[model samples]
Target: MNKLRLIEMIFFLFCSLLSASQKPNILFIIADDLKASVLGTYGDKVCKTPNIDKLAEQSLVFDRAYCQGVVCGPSRTSFMHSRYRGSMGTNLAEHFKNNGWYTARVGKIYHMRVPYDIINGTDGQDIASSWTERFNSSGREAHTPGDYECLNLNIFTDKLEHRESTKMPNRMFVSVSYEGDGSDQPDYKSASKTIALLNEHKDKPFFIATGLVRPHYPNVAPEQYFTPYPWEKIKLPTIPENDLSDIPNLGKSKIMNTNNSIGKYIDNQKKMWSAYYATVQFMDEQVGRILDELERLGLKENTAIVFLSDHGYHLGEHGFWQKENLHEEVTRVPLMVYLPGIKAGRTSSITELVDIYPSLTELLGIETPQEVQGKSFLPLFEQKNKTIRTEALSLLTNGKGYSIRTKDNTYMRYKDNSEELYDMNKDPKQFNNLAKNPEYSQLLKNLRSQLDLRLKQEAVTIPQKIKKVMIYT
Candidate 1:
C-alpha cells in the first residue's frame, strides 16, 4: 500500500472508533400508577409539578401513549420484553448489558407490589440476569407511623391487635400525609442511589433505570406535598348517575365494588384525590433531583432520558379507585423521551409501551432481538407529525378482555361476547357508550375486525410438551 493511502485508511478507522466510544448513555425513569392527565404539561390545572413540567418542555411528549397491560406485572413484563406478556422471555436491561453498555436497576423496575415488597425488600419477579447491579430502597416509608387514621382503617407504627391489615379493601380509597422530612422515604433513597450510580458511570456508556413507587397505594407523602392541594380546592371527578348501567358485565367485573361505600362520602372522596395528587408531586420531586444530578455531572447533553409509568391510575374516575380495568384512565400512561439534538415538543401520534424497545435500539444503533413484537417509532423523533401505528392495544383479565385505541375512538371486547365502543372526539370522558346504538354498528364491526387481527398478530404461543419415546433411541 502507498504511504498516503495507508494513512488515509488509518485516519478513517480512528474516527469511527471515536464516534463509537462517544455513544450516548440512557437514563430510564419509570413511575408507578402515574396517569398522563395529572401533569402540568398534560393540561392538569391543579397539580404543581414544575420539575416534571420542565422535563416535558424538553421532551417529545407522547400525548396518547398506552400500556400493553392494565396492571403492573403484565404491563411491565410486556414493555421490558418489547412484546406482549408471555410472548417471549426477554429482558430489556439484559439486552443492553449483553451489548456493550453497563446496566443497573434501582427500586421497583419490575412488578413489586407496593408496601408489601417495599416493607420486606423483596425481589418481586425482577429479571435477575438483567442488571449488572441492583438495589432496593428500604426505608421508614414502608413502615407507617402508628398515629395515622383513615376512614377505613388506622395505621399504627406499632402493630395493634384488632386493627385491620393495610391491604384491606376500604383502605385503598384513603391517603395518609406523613408530617416529617421525606429523607427516609424509599423513593428518596432510590433517587440518592441513582445519582451516585450516575456519577460512578458518567464516563462509561450505561443504562440506569430508576423506579419510583408512590401514587400507587397507601397514598402517603411528605406533609409539604399535601399542603399545596387543600381539601377545599380538590375537585372530585364528575360521575353521571347510573354510570355502570350501560357497561357490560365483563367491564363491570373489573371495577372495585368495595370502594363504592367509600365513594358515597363526598369529603372522603376529596381527601383521597388530594392524597393521590400529593403523592404524585412527591414522586416528581425525586425525578427532578435525579435529573438535576445528571445535569450537574455534565452528562445531560449526551444521555437519552426516558420517563413513563408502568400503567395509568384511577382516582374516582368511572367510580373506580385503582387499576385493573380496560378504560382509558387505567390504560393510557404518560410517556416522554428526550434525545439530544432533537427538537422537543408534543406529538399526538398514538404510541405503545412496546414501541419503546425498538425505538431505543434504533436510536443507539443496537441490534434488536427478533422476538420483539413492537415496531420502531424512531421516525417520529425526526418527523413529529408521523403516525407509527393505527391503534394501540391493551390486554386485561388474562386476555379475556381487550381494548383497542385508535385516533378517533376506543373499542373494548369481552370474552362473554359483550362489547363497548366510544367516540373519543365527541366524549373524551367516555361518559356515553355508543356500542348498542344502531347507527354505529358498522363502525363497531370494523373495529372488532381490526382488534382481532392485531391480537392475532401479537399473540404469544405457549410451549407444548415434548414426546418421550424418541429420547430413548
Candidate 2:
C-alpha cells in the first residue's frame, strides 16, 4: 500500500473510535398537526403548554420552520428522508442505525393514518430500516365510553348515538371528554414506553424517535384536561363571509376535513376551540412526563433533544378547517433543538423540516450523503440572523403543484397553470390574491422562474417497474 493511503486509513480508524465513544444520545420528539402559533412559547395567550414552554426556554427555537408537505403522510416522509417527495434516500434514523448506533421508534414517526391506524394498533407505511425496534400506541378513539358530543348535529350524550354509523365513525367532528387519568390515551402510552426504552438502552449510543399524536383529530382527552379550558372562555378566529371567493379551486381542500360540518359552526365554535385546546394541553403533559424521566436518569446533559411537528394545522384561518393548503397556517411548523454544548437561542431565519437530518449530522460531525438536498443550518445556532436559504418550498397534495415562501411574499402554482400570489407584508391573513393584478407581474415572473429552476434540478423518483434491464430471456 502507498504511504499516504496508510495514513488516511489510520486517521479514519481514529475518527470511528472517537465517535463511538463520545457521541451523545439523540432524543427526537415529533407532534402531529401542531401549528407554530398555538404554543405558549410561540405567542399563544390562551393555550396551556407549560412543559413544551419549559423545553423551549432551554432550546434553540426556529421561528419560521416550514414543512415540505402539508398533510401527515407526505410531510413526515419528506422530512424523515431529508429529501423532497419526488426524491428518496436513506432516512435519518436508518442513517444512524447504519453507523452502529442503536435507533428505535416509539410511535407515529412515519405516516400513520389518524384514528384508523391507532385503532388497528398498526402503522403499515413505517420503514423498517429506520429502527432497531418499534412499538405502536393504540386506543379506541371515539368508541371509548365518554361524554360524546356531535356539536354540528347538536347531539350531546354520554354515549355516541346509534345513528352514527360504524363505518367512518368520528371521521368528522366528535369531541369526547373521557373519564380517566389520561393514562389510556395513545400519547401517554407512547411517553411511558419511551421512558421504558430509555431505561433499557441507556448504556448504548441511541437515536430514539418518539412521535406523539395529539391535537390531530377527534379532539379526545381526559376530563381533567378539559377542565382547564372552558367553552365560554374560548375565542374563535375571525371568519369573514365569502372568504373563499378570492381563493382558486386548487387552493381549497377537495377531500373531507376532520372538522368540516354542514352548518351550525356558529353555536359550536367556542366548544370546538375549547376541545382543541384541551387536546394540545394533554399532549404537552405527556412531553413533561418524558422530560422528567430523562432528567431523572441523569441523561439530560448528554442527550440532544429535538421537538418538531410534521406540519402546521389550520384553526379556521381563511375559512380553512384543516391542513392540505399552502397557506402559512398549514405550512409553518414548530421546531426547536437542544444540544448539550451549544447555548440555547432562537432564530427568525427561514428553515425547512428537511433541513433537520442534515443539521443533526453536521452538528455531530458525522459524514452525510451527497444526495441529501437539505442544507445544514447548525451555524444558525451561533448566528441567529444568518439565513441558509432565501425561500422554503412546500408540496401541496392532490394535483395542486407547489408553493414557495420567501421573506416578503408567497407564490403558489397549480397543475392547471393557474397561480395565486400574496403580498405577505400587506395581507398576513392572505385574504387578497394579487396574482391577477398587472402591478405585480414582474414579481410573479421571478418567483415562477425560481420554482421552475428548483423542479429541473430535483431528481425524480419514478417507479422501478418501468426501468430498463438487460434482456435475460
Candidate 3:
C-alpha cells in the first residue's frame, strides 16, 4: 500500500474506535400530571423547574408531544409498552414483559399503591413473569386515613365520594396521601433504588423504571416549596364567563359535569395555582436529586434521558380541575430527550410521547415492533423545529372525544359528531370555538380527513397467527 493511503486508513480506524467506545446511558423521568406551560422555560412566569429547564436547554424539547389517552392507567400503559391505543388492549404490562427488557418499577408505574399493591413483594398489576426483580413502597399513609386536614382548602377539593379534598377512590390499606416523608420520602427511595441498579449493571445494559408520585392529585409538598411565589405574587388564570357559549353542546357536556364542582369558585384559583406550583417545585427538587446521582456516576453521556408527564392538568381553565377533557392546557406536556450520540440542545415541533418506543429504537439503530403505532421521531430530532407530524391526536373513551391539534388549529370531535375548532394562532388560550363557522368548512374537512387517516392507521392490533405442530412421519 502507498504511504499516504496507510495514514488515511489508520485515521479512519481511530475514528471508528472512538465511536464504538461511546454508548449513551438512558434516564427516563416522568412527572405524574405536569403541564407544558408550567415550567420556567416554557414561559410559566412563576413556577420554577430549574432542573428540567436545564435539561431542556441542552436537549431536544418537543413542543407538540401528547399522550395516547388522557387518563392515568390507559395513558401510562400505552407509553410503557410503546404500543398505540388500540393495540394495547389493556395489556401493556404483558406486551412489554414479552419483549426482552428487564423492567422494574419502584412506585406508581402501573396505577397501583405502594407496599399494599406490592403484596408478597409483587403487585399483580405488574407483569407476573416480566420483571427479574421488583420493589413496592406504599409509603406511610392511607387515603383520608381517619380524616386529617392540615392543608385542606375548598378550591382544591374534588367532589368525588372521598373524605379528603381529592376524588380518588380509597381502599383499606392503600388510600390517598400515603404517609412516609412526602416529597423527600418517595423521591429518595426511587432514586436510591435506580442508583443501586445502575451501579450493579454498569458494565452491562439494563432497562430500569423509577416512578415518582408527586404533583398528582392531593398536591401536598413541603411548605418551603411555596416560598418562591407568595399568594400575592402569584397570578391565577382568567375565567371568561362566556367561554362556554361558543363551544359545541357535546364539548360543553364533557367539560361541565354535575360532579365537577371542585372548581366552581374561580375566586379560589390562586390557592389551586399555588398548590400546583408548589407540587411542581417539589417534583423538580426530586428530579434534581436523581439527576445528581446520574451526573456523579458519569451516566449522562452514555445514557439517554427522557423526561415526560402522563398528561397535563387544568388549573382553573375552562372550569376543569383534572385531565379527561380536550384542551391544550390539559393535553400538552413537556418532553425532553438527551441522547449523547444523537442530537442535543435542539427543539422539535414533532409530536412526542407514546412515540418513545419507535423513536428510541430508531435512535439505537434497531427495528421497531410490528404492532407499534407511534412513528419514529429520530428524523425530527435531526431537523429541529421542522414538521414531523402535521397534526397530533389524543383520545378519551369516557368522554368519547378525539382531539386533533396542529401548528395553528385545534379541533375536537365528539361522540355525537359535533365539532369544536379553534384557531390557536389567534387565541392561544382557546377562549373561542369556531366549529360552527361556515367559512372554515373546508379547513374542518381537511382536519377530519387527517383524523380518519390516523384512526385507520392505528386502529387495532393485527391478529397474529398461531403455528401448528408438525406430525412425525
Candidate 4:
C-alpha cells in the first residue's frame, strides 16, 4: 500500500479504539403504552415478569416516573429532544452521534402510531436526525394471521384470514393470539434486528435503542405466552360505579364511554386484561433475549441499560381503556437504569421522561447541552433521597390539561376550568376528588398556584433554525 493510505488507515483505527475505550455503550429499551402498575417489580400483584424483574434486581428502579405529554407523539418528542413539546433542540441519539458515537434505533423509538403505523409499515412522525441508522419493523398488526377478536364488540376474525381493511378503528382494541412462535411480530423482529446490530457494532462506542411494541394495540403474542393468562385467571379490581363520575368530560378517554353492549362489559374487560398480560409477558421475554446476547458478547459490563415505557396506559381503570387522559394510570410509567458499577436500588423520587437525556449525559461524563430542560437525577444512585425536583409536571397536548405531582398530592387542572385533587399519599387509587370538598380548600389553592408558576417557568422560545416538527396525529 502507498504510505499516505497506510497512514490514514492507522489514524482511523486509532480514533475508533480511542472512542471505544473512553465511552460506554447505551442500550435503551422502551416498551409501548405500558403502565408501571402491571410490572412485577412495580408491586403488580398478578403479572409474572421474570426477565424484567430480574433486570430490576441489577438496576435502579424509579417508582414515581412520569411522562410530560398525555399521548405518544408529544410525549416522545418531548423526551427525545430533552425539552418540552413546543421547544426545539437536538434529540438524544443525534447528540451522541454528533459526538462521534455510532447511534442506531430499532423499532418504535420516537412517536409512531400503534396499529396504523405498524400496519402501514411507516415511520409516523419520526425525527430523521436522531440516529445513524433507524429501522421500522412492520407486522400485519391486527391482521397478523392470528385468532383476532374484538372483545367489546364480540367481533371475531378467523386465524386464516387477513384484515379486510387497515382503517378499522376497533383495531386498537382488538387482541390476537398468534398461531406461531411470534417471529413475525414487530417486537420480535425488532429484538432480532437489535441483536444483529449489537453483534455488528460491538466494537464501537454506540447508542442503541430498542423500542418494543407490545401490550400496545392488537395485543399480539404467541399462543404459548397466552396460556398463562387465561380469561378465567384474568383479574381486574372491582371499582365503584361512581369511580369515574368525578372526572371531568375532557379528562376521560374515549373508551370510558364507548357504545359497547353492557352485557359484555365485564367479559370484555377480562379478555382485554388477559391479552395485555400475555403481551407483556412476551415483551419481557424479548428483553431477556437481548440481555443474554449482550452478556454473551461481553458487552454488559461496558454498557448502560435503560428500560422504560413511553407513558403509562389505563388497564380498565375507572372504565378507561387507553392513554391520552391525564390520570395516574396514564401518566406514571416505569423507569429502570443499570449503570455498570452502581448497586441495585429503588426510589420513589419523582422523575420525568425528559430527565433521561441529561441523566445519561451526566452518567457518562458528557457535557449536557444548555438547551436541555431536564434535571439530572444521577445522585440518586448512591443517595436515594436526593431531591432532583420537588415536583413532577405533566400535561396534555396544547396545554389542554396540566398536572402537578408532589410528594403528598396530585392536582390536575383541565382547560374547561374543572379541577381534580387527590391526596396521593392517602388516596393512591384517586377515588375521592377533594376539589369539590370545602375541607381541603386551602390545599387546593396552594396547588393551583404551584401549577401556574410551574407552567410559566417551563414555557420557552424555540430555536428558529429547527430542522423538523411533527404534528401529533
Instruction: Report lDDT (CA) for all predictions.
Output: 0.79, 0.79, 0.62, 0.81
Error of 3 at 394 (Å): 0.8
Q: Compose the digit string of candidate 2's lDDT tens values, residues 1-473.
A: 44335334433432443345666688999998889899999999989999999999999999888998788877787788776673366789998999877999988988887777787899647888889999999987776679887766766788555523224543445678988998889999999999999999887788999998888877789888889888887777775777777778888764332335623466576677778899999999999999999999987867889999988887666656668888898888999998765678899888999899987776555778775778877667667768778888888754467888888899999898878899988987788889989999999999999888766664243334331211100
TM-score of each: 0.91, 0.90, 0.81, 0.92
Candidate 4: lDDT over CA atoms? 0.81
- Candidate 3 total steric clashes: 15
Best by lDDT: 4
Stretches off by above 4 angstroms in model 4 are 1-20, 159-165, 257-263, 460-473
Per-residue lDDT over 300-367 for candidate 3, one digit per residue giving the tens place of the 0 to 100 score = 65666788888887766766556776788877888887765444655547484677876665554445
- Tens digits of per-residue lDDT, candidate 1, 233-307, equal 788888888887788877763434343665456676677778888888989999999999999988887888999
Among all windows of ten consecutive residues in candidate 2, which has the lowest summed lDDT?
464-473
* Per-candidate clash tally: 2, 0, 15, 0
RMSD in angstroms, all models?
6.9, 6.2, 7.9, 6.9
Worst 10 residues of 4 by lDDT: 6-15
